[model samples]
Target: MLSMHYIQKGLLFKKPPPPNNQKDFIDNLLENLKQSISLALFHFYPLSGRLVTRKTQDPPTYSVFVDCSNDNPGARFIYATLDATIYDILSPVDHPPVVESLFDLDRAINHDGHTMPLLSIQVTELVDGVFLGCSMNHCIGDGTSFWNFFNVWSEIFQAREKGRDAVVSHQPFHNRWFLEGCGPLINLPFKHHDEFTSRFEAPKLRERFFHFSAESIAKLKAKANEEANTNEISSFQSISAFLWRSVTRARGLAHDQKVSCKLAINNRPRIKPPLPKEYFGNSVDVVSTETTVGELLENDLGWAAWKVHTLVVNHDDTEVREMYEKWLESPIVYQLGRHFDPFSMVMSSSPRFNMYGNEFGMGKAVAVLSGYANKFNGNVTAYEGYEGGGSMVLAVSLLPDVMGALELDEDFMNVISVANFANMP
Candidate 1:
C-alpha cells in the first residue's frame, strides 16, 4: 500500500466518425460507460470498496485493509466537456497541463481512499475526440490488476453495445497469494496514517513523450550485447541503460555523484508455486541498481545494460522472501514530498500492455497518457506505441533545462526518432 498513487491513464478515441447529433452521441456514450463500469464492478467489486486504517495497541502499529461490506461507496463517475480539441493534447511534443483535467481525484494520495472512491472515471468530451480517464487506487493492486480491469471494462462496454454477453477468456482472480503476513489485520510500523499520508506538491518540470521505433530498439539491444561481449541483455535492460546514461549526461551531474535506477518487477512468476497470472492484487516488487554518474557515462551501453540485466535476472525466490521479511521488520510508509535523490530515476508501466486495444465500440484509441499524481522530476512512464510492432513511447519527466538539453542532444535524438541508427548525421 506504499508506492501506489491512483494510476491515471486512458485512451483517446477520435470523435465517433462524423459524431452525429453531438448531444445525443455524448449522452448515449456516457450512459453506456456508466453502465459498463457498473457491470465490470460486479466482478471486480473490491474496487468499489474503501480502505480502513486503525491503530493497534499491543504492537503500537497501524492496520490497513479494504472494506468491501455495505460501506462500499462504489466507483465514481464524472462527465465533463472541454472547449479544446484532441489536437491540443496530441499535437505538442511536450505534455500539456490540460491533460490532467481528464481524470478525477487530482493529486489525491491513496490514503484518502479511506473516504474517497477507490476508482474514478471521467469522460471528457472534445471536439475532435473523447478521452476516457480512469484513476484507480494503487494500494489495492498493481498495474497488472489495474489494466485487467481496464480491458474488462471495455469488454463489457462493447458487449452492452452489441446486446450480447461479454465473453472474457479469463476473469480477474481476486484471491491474493502471499508468502508473508498480509491480513485483514496486519500491523504496520506507524501509529497514525497522517504522519506519512498527506498532500504535497511535486516539483515543477517538463514532461515529454519520446518515441523509439522497433528498429531503433533492436539496435540498442544488439549493440549492448555486442559491446558487453555477451548475448544475455534484454531489450528493456538495454533501453533503460541507454536512457539512464542519456538523461544523466544531459543533466551534467558531477562525475562521482551517485544515481539510481528503479523499476517495478512483477513478482507473480518469480515466487515458488508461482501465483496465477490473473491474480488481482499487489504482486509488484520494486528492484533497483545504483552506480556513480561517471561510471554510467563512461561505460559502454552493453556494460550498463548488463548491470541492469543482472539485477533483474538474478532476483530469485530467495531474494523475494528476504525482501518481504526485511520489510516486515521496519515498515515505513512514504511521505508526499520529494521521495528520492535529485538524480534518481524510476521507469514504470511498459510497452507490453494492451493499451491501444481499449475499443468501446468507438474504434481503436489514437493515443495513451497518464494523470499528474506521481509526476516528479526523473519519473518516466512508458506505453506501447499506438502503431504497435515493438515501438515504444516513453513519457519522460525532468527539469525544464534538462529536458531542453536532451531534445538537443544529437546522440539521444538519433535513437528517439523513427529512423534507424545507421542513418546518422
Candidate 2:
C-alpha cells in the first residue's frame, strides 16, 4: 500500500572552471538543460504525460496508464537558489536536512502524477555550486532506467552545443512487458489505496557517508571468500555482509532477534533471452536474506557474504519466472520500499550505474546525494566513487544510537575510508 513517491537524487557540481564575461553561464546552462529535456521527452513520452487511474468492478482493481494526450503537462523545471554550501550538504557527521529542498515537487507522491508533472527537475544554485536534482515517479522506471534516460539527455545536450546530430547510445526501449495474464491496461486489486498526496514520515535517524576504495572493496571480497573457503564471493555480497555484521553488532539486539537485509535486483538480464539493454520502466524485483543476530555476529564476514551471495545466485531465471507467475495470479507489485522495521536494513541502488558519466558539457558531477524520501533506519544508498576506479560510496542511515555504536565499531571502519565521522571514539 506504499511507494507513492518520486525517486529524487542530486548531482553536485562546482561552478564552471572559469566564469565567462561574454554571456551568463547559468542562463545558458539552464536553457540547454530545458532543451535537452524536451528532446529527451520525445523518446520518454511518459514523463511528459499524466497518469490516468480508473476504477474497475468485479475485482475491485485499479487500472493505470500514462495519458499522452496533447494537453497534458510535461516535465517540470525548477530553478532555486540556495544559501548553503556543498560541504554543508555533504557533511558526514549528520546529513543536512536542507538537501530535501533541492527537489521541485512539494510532498507530491507518485499517484499525484495525474495532476502534477511526472518528472520534476530542480536546479538549486548553491552559494558555491549547483545541485541538479530530479524527481521522477517510481512508476516511470527504476534507478537504472532513469539513469539511462539521463545519460541520453546529456548526450543530446552535448551534441546540440557541439552543433551536430546527437549520436545517442542507449536509446530508451518503451516496449512494456506485462505478465502473462495481464493486458496493456493492467488491473490490480486495490480496494483501498493509500493517500496519494501525502508522504509518510520516516523515523529520524543518523546518517553517515562511508567510502570504500577499490583496494578496500577487493580486500572485503577476498576476506569474505577466504573465510568462507569458497572463491565465489562477489564484491556486493562481501560489502553487504560486512554491513550486516557491523550493524547487527552495533545494535546489540537480543541474541535470538532476527534481522533481514533487503536488496533490489534488476530483472532485465535475469529474464529468459534477456530484455533489451535500454529496456525502460520498472523491471525491478526484491530479494531478502535473514538470520538471527547471534548467528550473524558469531560467524565471520565470509559466512554472511556467502549467505547474501547464495540468495542472489539462486534467484535465477526459473525463480524469476515463478515470481512473475505468482504475481500475475496475485500481484504484489512494488519492488522497492519506504517503510522498514527497526531491525531491518536495505541496501539500495547500485554502484555500477553511470553516475560520473553524466557529463552535461560541464565536468562530471563531484558527488551524489539522495532526497529524504526513503530515509529510514538502516537504509543505505550505494554509488560509485566520483574518482572513477572500482571505488564505492555508501550513504547509510541508521538509528541515532546504532549510528553512534557504528561509529565506534572498529570492524566497519577498517574497510571504509570515513568521509566525516568515522573517527568518533
Candidate 3:
C-alpha cells in the first residue's frame, strides 16, 4: 500500500547493458516473488506507489519494498538510494547483494518478533523504480519458507520464459477447520505454560554467518551416520544432533544442572486436507524434549537423533490437530512460543537442498544468505550447499561463548577445516 526507497551503490559486477528488453532481470525477480503469495505481494510492491506520508499508524512489519527503475539504463544508481552489496566469500561468483553500510534499515524492528521488516532497496536507473524489503513476520515462517517461495517463483519465472503460464493455487491453513477437528486447546489451564514461561528469561539474539565446506559436511555426516549405525540419517539430522548435544551440554556447563531442548512442530498436514506447500504463510506446531547434560554429552549421536525422531513421529495428525484446534479456540496459543520456558534453549534446523546456487544466466551466485539471529535462548540454524559444490554454509546466532564453545569442540570443528572441506569440494 506504500512505496519506500533505499540505494544500492556497489559495483554492478559488469554493469548490465541498457534496459532495452521487456524482461528486466531485477524486475522479473521482484515480480516472480510477488506472485508466489497473493496478499503477501502487497507487502513488497514496487516504488511506483506513493510513499506513506502520514504521521503513521500500523505496527512495522519489518517488510521492505525495492524498486530499481533508472532513467539512464546504463548509469550508476544514486548513492543515497541503496542499502548494501553482496559480501565477498571464497567462491567464484558474487554472493547475495549487500547494501551499503550507512543505510539505516539494518536495525532489528520494534514490532512483534515475528513482524519486523528486515531490508530496504533502491535503484536510480529506472528513475521511478524502487524496491522494498519486507518480511512475513518470523513466527509465520522461517528462511525455509522464504527460500522455498523463491524456488517456486523461479520455477514460475522459467515457465514464463518458455512462453508457458504456470498457475498455482495455494490452500491456506484454515483455523476454523482445525478448531472443528480437535475442539479448543488454547484455554486449557495447563500449568505447563505458566511454569515454563517463568523458568527462563528472554534470550538475546545475534546474527552471524558460518561456512562449512561441502566436503566437510558430507564427510562429517557420513562419519556421524557410520558411528550412529543408521542408514536413514541425513546431514541435517546428524548436524542437528551435534548441535543439540552441544547446546544442552553448554546449558549444563553454565548452570551445573540438567536441561531440555525444544524443536518446532510445523502442523500443516495435521489440519484436514492439509495446507499446500505453496501456502505462503505461517502453518506450524511446536514441541520439546528433555535430556540431561550428561546423557547428551556421553551418549552416541544415534541417541540424540532417535530422540529428535521420536518427538517428530509421535506428534501425529490427531495430537497435532487437536492441539491446533485448541489454540484456534483460545487464540492464546499463538503466544505460547513466546512464553514457554521448560527448555534452556530452542532450535530449528532447516535442510537447504539444491536450491542455493540457482543460475539466471549470470554465473551462479557465490553465496546465499539468511539474516538469522538467535534470541530468547532460541537459535535458528540453516545449512545450504553452495554452487559448484564447495562448502556448506551454516548461518546461526547465539551467545559468543556458546558459539565459540561449539566451534572449539574437536568433533564439530574438525569437520569444518578447509582441508576437511576440500575433501568434499
Best by lDDT: 1
Off by over 4 Å in 3: 1-134, 138-145, 156-177, 181-208, 212-232, 250-256, 269-274, 326-330, 333-345, 352-354, 357-363, 372-378, 388-392, 417-425
**Candidate 1: misplaced stretches above 4 Å?**
2-4, 58-61, 180-184, 336-338, 418-425
True-structure RMSD, every candidate: 3.4, 3.2, 10.0
lDDT for each candidate structure: 0.83, 0.80, 0.43
Candidate ordering by lDDT (highest first): 1, 2, 3
Tens-digit lDDT track of model 1 for 1-425: 55337779988787765538878888899999999998999889899999887775865767788889975778899998898877777766679999999999988888889889999998998887889999999888788888889989999999889999988755989876655545546677677665567566777799988888888989999999999999899888888999998999889999899998888788889899787877898888778899999999888898889889999997888999888877777776655364556788888887888787788867888788888977788888888876778988898999999999998899999888631111111
Error of 2 at 32 (Å): 0.8
RMSD of 2: 3.2
Query: Candidate 1 vs. truth: CA RMSD?
Result: 3.4
| Candidate closer to the true structure by TM-score (higher is better), 2 or 3 | 2
Provide TM-scores for the models: 0.95, 0.93, 0.60
Best by TM-score: 1
How much is 417 displaced in model 1, in angstroms? 2.3
Q: Which stretches of candidate 2 lie over 4 Å from their true place?
A: 17-19, 58-61, 195-198, 333-339, 420-425
Tell me model 2's lDDT, rounded to 2 decimals. Answer: 0.80
Across 323-358, the per-residue lDDT of candidate 2 in tens digits comes to 877866785544224346778888988999987788
- State the lDDT at 382 in candidate 3: 52
